[model samples]
Target chain A: MISAVSAPDPDVYLMLRVRDGDEDCFGVLLDKHRNSLVHFLYRMVQDQPVSEELAQEVFLRIYRSRASYEPTARFTTWMFRIATHLALNWLRDQKNARSEERLDEQWEVADRKPSVEQRMVYQARLQEIRDAIASLPDKQRAAVLMHKYQEMEYSQIALVLESSESAVKSLLFRAYETLRARLAHMVTGGTR
Target chain B: MNCPLLSEQTSDVLLDYSAGRLDAARATTLQKHVLVCDACSAFLAGQAEVWAALDTWKAPPVSISFNRRLWQKLRFRIWKSAVPVAAAALIIMIGFVYDHKSQKSQMEIDQVERTLDDIQLLRQFDVARAL
Candidate 1:
């Protein structure tokens, strides 16, 4: 039950309408969250096509489960919960799969940079960051992505990860600590 | 104001400060403490750099056909589900037609039998008349 003090979430209202057979509401929810959801999955899997497929699966699952959806938490929390599960499962399945990002794709995006030298440096640094993040333990990766990128509250992340808030915090700290060690060179003046 | 780095809970305070989630009052307190606490200040600076580096990795824009692809998949799933029901209905109709045809054939055989019996009775009556 929603506490009396908390204002009703607009997404939850939209979801409830979806529960009541409002197809338009589902579209609205999808339009609002599709990019973030896909981005989260993309970061998790480190593969765009796989992430896109997983995102579609996530929405498909949501659409499938609309009949039974309850306003138990924020719509995004629930959505990410499902997304995290799918991403984790995919990662587990592809445990031995290469974790490399397609550099050409990054180059395409990096083309917006002013000079070839600047683009090359940016690409190299971006690759390092991606590798550092991809090197984290799967759970830690999920936690950090949710905390850092999604800007999800620790409690919401816990709900998504099905762990306690403290555990989530610990996961994030460890993940960041690993990242800091790996990417310390990026810090200003090269030493933190 | 004990050093936030000394314990797990306090370390999280450091994280909150870096993330800007700390309240203004606590933020001021931490900021003042950081001026003298090299450990906390270094931790915050490192975290700041990490945050900045992370910000550079923007997510790729979502595909334009994402919704269309999803709707197509949904439509296919619906049709996939309907295929079995349609097959079942077809099977039931075939069974009913077969049963009805079998019943009609039985009635035709019964009519044929009655006609042969009538022929036999008349032949017997004609033989009786000849005797």
Candidate 2:
């Protein structure tokens, strides 16, 4: 039996209220997780609009499954589990739809009128970093995003990815190695 | 403690160590190894730089209407899901009312039949007295 002194997760408490037919609780949850969820999905899909749509779907799914929700783990774990599943599926579908469109599109930099040389160099380095990350395998990219952006632990990442802790670690290690190699010149403040 | 040299398999230990995930005993062991190993030390430094750089790649802020649009969608979904439940409840309530009305009518019919039978018996007794 669990100890009473160990309080439940605040999100879990809200979710329980949601399960009991309190729609307001769902709004609270959505407000809390929307940014993080969208950001996570944005990193995963690299498309802001698509990420927002997918994040909306994630909330819809959570609400739909509210009645059957169990506090088996942290609410964020379950939430990300759904988000990751949706993102992977979306990525897979996107991959099949257009195989040649895998390159990262040029993101529009802010409209600051810096020196031409400085701007070009900055854009190139930023694009290089984005491209390097975009080139990672799907699982590796997901693992890295969860670790780096979400700041999730390996165990939590494994739960979300449906993999083992060691597997999550291995994925992150490989992912960082790739990033390190590609961005080594940047780290050393040298032009590639 | 015998410090094991870092290998391909143990390379992840550097990552875990850099991320501050190792337990005290294991962290002490890896720290000892790093102190003697230049390669491992460099690896940790490179990884730390990579992590810092990755931190700069922030996602753009979501649109201002994100919450409003999401709330709209959620409300629609809730309304959509409620339709079936409402219809089912209506059907159940209608069936219950129909069953209740039928039972009440059956009881009323039985009462009428008993009153008719008593009238018939009274007429027969009055005819016998006349005879």
Tens digits of lDDT, candidate 1, A70-128? 78778888889899999999999998998656655655565464476766776778888
Provide per-model DockQ scores: 0.52, 0.30
lDDT of 1 by residue, B33-126 (tens): 8999988887888888889888888777788999999989978987998999999999999999999999999999999999999999999999
Per-residue lDDT of model 2, residues B1-131, tens digit only: 22343444456678777777778999998888789888888788888878766765667788789989888987898799799999999999999999999999999999999999999999999999999
lDDT of each: 0.85, 0.80
How many clashes would you count in candidate 1? Answer: 0
Which candidate has the highest TM-score of all?
Answer: 1
Q: What TM-score does each model's chain B reach against the true chain B?
A: 0.78, 0.50
The first chain of model 1 has a TM-score of 0.90
Instruction: State the fnat of candidate 2 relative to the true structure.
Output: 0.44
